[model samples]
Target chain A: MLTYANPNRFMQLARRLTRPVWGLSLACLIIGLYMAFSAPADYQQGMTVRIMFIHVPAAWMSLFVYTFLTVSSIFGLVFRHPLGHVAAKSAALIGAGFTLITLITGALWGKPMWGTWWVWDARLTSVLVLFFIYLGYLFIWKAIEDPLQAGRVSSVLAIVGFVNVPIVKFSVDWWNTLHQPASVSRFDAPALHSDYLWPLLVMALGFQLLFFALWLLRMQTEIFKQKLRVRRLGLVETSNGTAS
Target chain B: MEHVFYIGLSYGVTGVILCLLTANTLSAFFSFRKQIDDEFKPEDSANSP
Candidate 1:
């Protein structure tokens, strides 16, 4: 783990892993989409059941990515790992994208099934708050000029905002809501039929792999940006020294 | 078949968003790499001379 803390070593690893990760993600998404479309429609929801293939996976990823950001923020704070900050920063946009997809798809699914486009239900409200928290975390990084300070403030906010995750997860059970409770995560067994379950799981995996591939690319970009800043600063110093 | 619109729209929107995000990240990466390479080439030439 410490060995990877070195940015150069990490970049080398990232470059080597990039092609394989991308290939795997592409393969998974193709298989997942094929399975998703092939699955028969639900007896109750009819064709709308198809929305679950995308909606459920997006919802899962929204939370998963936030949790990932929180963990990376913690590493940045505790270990002072630069890579951690880069990772957390890169993940925020992707996580926000997932959250947006979740909310929009949920609305689409809800309009057809629940006879409404939006609801102020506990589960829905909490997820919206989670989305705002992602925005706020990203805002802190943008507003602060100093990288260290920005990272520290953002890390603190991320840690604090993590309380909302569980609230979003358990809101359906803890309170009355239009949203359905956990179907696939329960210890007993997934409530879904195998036909639906398999595709959902595959899509979830594909989304996760896609997230990782994007995250790595973003992190690599950030590392290069940092290097560029340093080189430019060196050039400035060299000119200043020569002038003096 | 009526519900097909909602399902199609949902997947379409998600697909668009993911594609945009992927494009933005990759473009930023390539641009930064180019900037860093350009910065280094000048320095290397100056140092050799």
Candidate 2:
């Protein structure tokens, strides 16, 4: 991993990876959607259960991407790897996108199942806070002119905000929220039957792959921007040297 | 059948968001790559034998 920390090498690997990752993601999404549509409707929820195919995966990705951001921020702060900052910075918007999808889909799912579009419950509120934290992290980067200072500040913010992740995860369990507790993840067998379980797992895998594809592309863009800035600075220095 | 609208809307919204994010990232990637290439064009041509 450290050896591939160099931006050029990372870009090479990313270029090689983007195509296969995207292909697999597309395949999974198509098959998952087909299975989701074909599966028998839940005896209780009926057709609305199809919403779970998207909602659960988006919710999973919201937490997963934040964890990615937190780990990348830690690498940036502790290891002082330049790529870590780039990775952390690039991941913010993608994470926010997933978070937004989670919130919106959850609301859509809730309206049909729980008879409400929105609720101020523990699980819902914590995820909302996570969304705001993402926005704040992005704003810090844009507001600070110096990349180093921006990176330092946002790294601290990400690390500190990571406490909310577990709270978001266990909120349903700890509190008497309207939200349901863990189904797919449990010590015992999953609560969901195989019909729904398979499609949900496939969709989750597709969403995760899609996140990686976007993250890689964004990181490449950031590296290019940094290179351009360095080149422009070099040109300015050269012109100044000639003038003097 | 009555709940079909809600289910469709959920999938539609998620699909739209994912598509937009993917498009935006790819667009940015290409734009930045072009800028970098244009910026270095002079040096590249100058180094040619």
Candidate 3:
């Protein structure tokens, strides 16, 4: 995993894979969207049920990306892998974007389906906390001028905030909800019908692939920016030394 | 289900956002690379001296 940190090697691999990724994303999304639309609406939930296809996948992605970001941050801090910080920062920001979409789409869905734009339920509250964690991670990156120190500080926040992830997952399980409980879990079989289940899965897969492609591209950009930052700082220090 | 509106909104929003993110990432990558390359040029090579 750490071996991918070599920027030249990473770029070599990234350039080779970039075209295929875009092609795959295009195919997956086209097919997935068709299936998502084709699925019959719930008799009880009615047309608003259509929003579940989008909302559920977005909710799943928000959690998955945040977990990926946090684990990478730990790997960067504990193992001192150079690429860890880049992966973590890029993923955090992207994850935050996904989380925002989740909340927005959820609210939209909730407005029609649940009769409210917001709720104080455990599941909603925990997800709200997850959003804040993402914000805190972004603030750390923006506030610190020194990238290394910023990385160091945010890694701590990321690792600590991970405790909330499980809390989010369990909130729906532990508490009763007007919102439906988990459909799929590793321990228990999914509750959704095969008709509705398949499209949701495909859309989820498409979203994950898109997430990876975006994360890789952004990580590459951040790495280049770091190189530029070091070069600029070195120039400033040397100019001062010569003048003095 | 409202056939046109929901599907239109979902796909419309997704497409526009993806396009924006892709363009934004590419611009940042190429521009940052150019900045770093210029900083390391021989004429302004502070570390070389």
Candidate 4:
């Protein structure tokens, strides 16, 4: 872990991992989709059960990514890990994208089953709040000019905002929500049948891979931006010295 | 099937958004890489010492 604190080493690891991660993601997605379509529809939900392949994995990623962001923020804030802020900031947009997918697909799935486009159910509302927190985190990055200050502010916000994660996860169980409770993840045997469970896991893995691939690319970009900033500053200082 | 529209739209929207995000990230990456390389080219380094 400390090895990655060195930006050059981190860059090398990112370069090496990006292509393979992407390839594996594509492979998993292809297999996952095939299995999803082939799986039998729920007797109750019918054909609409197919939507779970994409939707459930996306919802998982939404929470997973934010948790990852929070961990990275902790590293940055507490340990002053150099790449920590870069990792957290790079992850924000990708996490937001997943959150958006979760909301949109959740609504799409909800409409046919619930007889409505949306509701203020505990599960639904908490997830929406999670999305807003993601947006707020990104806004902090954009609103502040100084990278160090932006990182500190956003990291603090991320750590504070993570309180919503547990609420979102437990909302279905804690309240009489229209949304269903955990199917794939639970203390007992998963609620999903093997048919749905297998492909859902595969798709979830694919989504996770996709997140890492994108996260690496975004982090490398941020590192390059930092390099450019430093080089420009050095050039300015050199010119000033010559002028003097 | 009536459910087809809902399912199709969901997948379609997901695909579009992921594609756009990928494109945006890739472009930003290349643009930043180019800028950094430009700032530290051979000529600039030769004059450093």
RMSD of each: 2.0, 1.8, 3.7, 2.2
* DockQ rank order: 2, 1, 4, 3
Q: What would the per-residue lDDT of candidate 1 be over residues A66-171, giving only the tens digit for each residue?
A: 9999999999999887788888999999999999999999999999999999999999999999999999998998899877789889999999999999999999
CAPRI-wise, candidate 3 is acceptable
Question: What is the lDDT, from 0 to 100, of the residue A215 in candidate 2?
Answer: 88
Error of 1 at A70 (Å): 0.8
**TM-scores of all predicted structures:** 0.95, 0.96, 0.86, 0.96
- Model 2 lDDT tens row, A63-151: 99899999999999999987888899998998999899989988988898999999999999999999999999999999999888999
- Write model 1 residue lDDT over B1-49, tens digit each, in one string: 7687898899999999999999999999999899888878887999999
Error of 1 at A39 (Å): 0.4
User: How accurate locally, in lDDT, is each candidate?
Assistant: 0.91, 0.91, 0.79, 0.92
Q: Report residue B3 deviation for candidate 4 (angstroms).
A: 0.5
**What is the lDDT for A207 in model 3?**
81
Q: Tell me candidate 4's interface RMSD.
A: 0.6
Best by lDDT: 4
Error of 4 at A100 (Å): 0.6
On residues A69-93, what C-alpha lDDT tens digit does candidate 4 reach at each position? 9999999999999988899999999
Q: Which stretches in model 1 have alpha-carbon errors above 4 Å? A: A1-5, B44-49
